[model samples]
Target chain A: MTDVPESSRTLPKNSGIQEIRLGFTLQHWCLWQSKETPFGEFWPGGEVLPYNGGRADVSFFPMMQSRRLSPLARAVSAVAWHSRQQCGDIPSVFLSSHGESQYYFEILQGMAGGEGVSPSRFSLCVHNAIAGLSSIHNASYQPYLSLAGGTEGMFAAFLEAGGILLETSKVLVVWYEQALPDAYQAYLATSETTFALSMILTRGGGPGHQLRLARRPGKGGSNAEDCTTSLVQTILEGRRSAVCHLEQSIWQWSLDDA
Target chain B: MKNLEAELKQLIIDTLELEGVNPKDIASDAPLFSGGLGLDSIDALELGVALKKKYHIHIDTNSAELANYFASIKTLAGFVVSQQNKSTL
Candidate 1:
């Protein structure tokens, strides 16, 4: 964790072009999905190991002690815990949309039913719990930034990552969502899925092709963003880059040949 | 008495989410908290709710006599037996 000089650490917000350019190299990554039962089951015929219905391996964090993590925490932490091992004690940014829905539903249901709320569920209600556990498990004192708003947490997560990657050598980014319990099916988003993606990204500008981000469609691009799951599929296939349609603007991702 | 202690052990493991721990590992007369199982305040609250629901007994966590009932698996089983006996009588 050597310090990057303050002046050159983050990407400039306004670069005068239709797109503000920021570069980052992808080093190592891990993905997790836990929609199906029988934890750690594999999904076949895909670059990512755990597919939509397969379970995540919770044994990654043996020191986590309690097996009491909710299915979402297990899935989210499995990938996050692994990335910390892969990336070392780097700073991180955690993003999740509606991750609170799982335990929130449980707590509210219990409270409404007049049963004492499960204290574990209550402790886990905070979105930062995901980031908190990641830091604790990694034994890193570095603050893991937490972002938990809007349907497009993945895109927002990267935007924040770009800011830090500009200043640091590497940043671990974890983006995830859990399958909303059956009771909340009506609120599901098209991009949201019960999956997580972990990445250790290095500061951009090196020899091999790296990922460069800008406002999609140039100045007047259509506000169409790729869903998080599909973006991963695109990246998995070794595509040049992906686009994420966001509010009012689209995020265009492309490979920068350096 | 042994059966009741074993039952209590499984209940604690299941309700508290103690991964990789076995019922046989828990000492029946050992403390359930504070240097024994090392469970925390939240675990106590959760266990209290579970005890009330399972035994159909009223467990006031704030009561002065509560510690005696939960000091160990042996004490918990004894409390349950006494409560059940009183109800049946």
Candidate 2:
């Protein structure tokens, strides 16, 4: 079990969701996965509706820029670009458990083998490289954030999006993750399937469903990986609410039709 | 000399992963960076590394003539031949 930090324990539950007007609305979202059937396939839980295809389709970028994006970045760019098409440009919060881990692993391996690092590879190995590339490709100067919040990263991103909503009319939240390298696979538990999900969030009193997030104090048996898929399922299925029992706290999400 | 220039064109395409670009399409005398091919600084560095690894030649990073040598496939082939002769000497 993970130890709850004293500072975090003292922090109020829901992390100021109520203070930020309870919750935000789900304006528009795009979910892209890696290995779905052409006709669309559902997970066993049957909560998430099938996606058309797992491909991201980032041909909008020029070859010079598109060629530089790693496979995961390609997915992220696809969803981010698609979600922002109607809205033009807006600030974004990017979340992932491990960003470009495969690329980082290759860089390390190159060094270990006495081969000098490729300058291009080194430049894109950072956690926020994709975010930076997306901004440059789109020519959008709107502020953006990249975060790796461990097991609660998805939930934490929502809280951050809510905070952004307080200041702006809309915020885009992009969540993407690929499987870690086999070397790190021994311990880290992440989704085997590579996926990226982007959601454009708006403040309360919107036309869409009202998505509320709150926390219940206590530990329960829950895998953080499942929480992410379940959260997406809860939204897509138009289910009322879903509770995720995490190691440190029980995170709950409720969606009310608006 | 012509064969070396052709080889250099293929090397550049392979090293930079310039998909859909063919060696035959690369003009021997055309600029390789910024203006003609539109490659940026990172591609320059990456190409430098690839050249060093393949030709077993040292690149003087601060040399005044470095940019001229990398300016075009024709110039790059000339530099490679010169370096090969010097190594044999």
TM-score of chain B of each: 0.90, 0.94
lDDT of 2 by residue, A1-258 (tens): 122332343226455343222477877777777775343332211122234365567778888888877778888888888887857789999988788999889989989998878888888988889999988887998999999866564787887887888889999888888888999888877677777888888997788867766665666787666677665554444455566777766776665668
Cα TM-score per model: 0.79, 0.86
Least lDDT summed over 10 consecutive residues: which range in candidate 2 chain A? Answer: A40-49
- Model 2: lDDT of residue A213: 68
Q: Cα RMSD for candidate 1? A: 7.2
Off by over 4 Å in 1: A1-19, A35-53, A63-66, A190-193, A207-209, A216-226, A256-258, B1-3, B64-68, B80-89
Model 2 bad stretches (over 4 Å): A1-22, A37-55, A221-226, A232-240
DockQ for the candidates, in order: 0.55, 0.69
Put down candidate 1 lDDT per residue, A210-236, tens digits, no spaces: 766665333332222235666555555
What is the fnat of candidate 1? 0.58
**Model 1 TM-score, all chains together:** 0.79
